[model samples]
Target: MAALCGLTSMHKIWDKLFKRGEFTELDVDEEVAGFAELLRERNARRVLDLGCGAGRHILHLSKLGFGVH
Candidate 1:
């Protein structure tokens, strides 16, 4: 299973599929962990998560002390 809707370059397709909650079976903890590490390295205090459907990433970012919008 693809972490975030496979390796498809076209994000719109994945966005549509994800928004409908079609790909909930995939595990993305590793990806999230890597992203959190990157944010910490960059000292990311704020984030603008556009197209943040379901607010999964947003929630994680919030927990990491990022002011997500």
Candidate 2:
């Protein structure tokens, strides 16, 4: 499945089919773990989540203390 969705580029397509319901919560930890480092370093309090779609990422980001604007 990784190769099919371009394993190297997984983020954008991950939620399309995988990030839903129980599975949605699973991805949250990993995405936050990875991006949190950057957010802290850059002090990215306000997040502009383009193509937010159902807003799964937005919710997670907000929980982590981001303004999520």
**TM-score leader:** 1
lDDT of 1 by residue, 6-56 (tens): 556557877898888885643447888799889899888898988646567
The global C-alpha lDDT for each of the candidates, from Candidate 1 onward, is: 0.76, 0.71
Query: Counting only residues 3 or more apart in sequence or on different chains, how many pairs clash (N, Cα, C under 3 Å) in candidate 1?
Result: 0
> What's the C-alpha lDDT at position 49 in model 1?
86
* TM-scores, all models, native as reference: 0.55, 0.51
- Where is model 1 more than 4 Å wrong at Cα? 1-28
Candidate 2: regions farther than 4 A off: 1-29
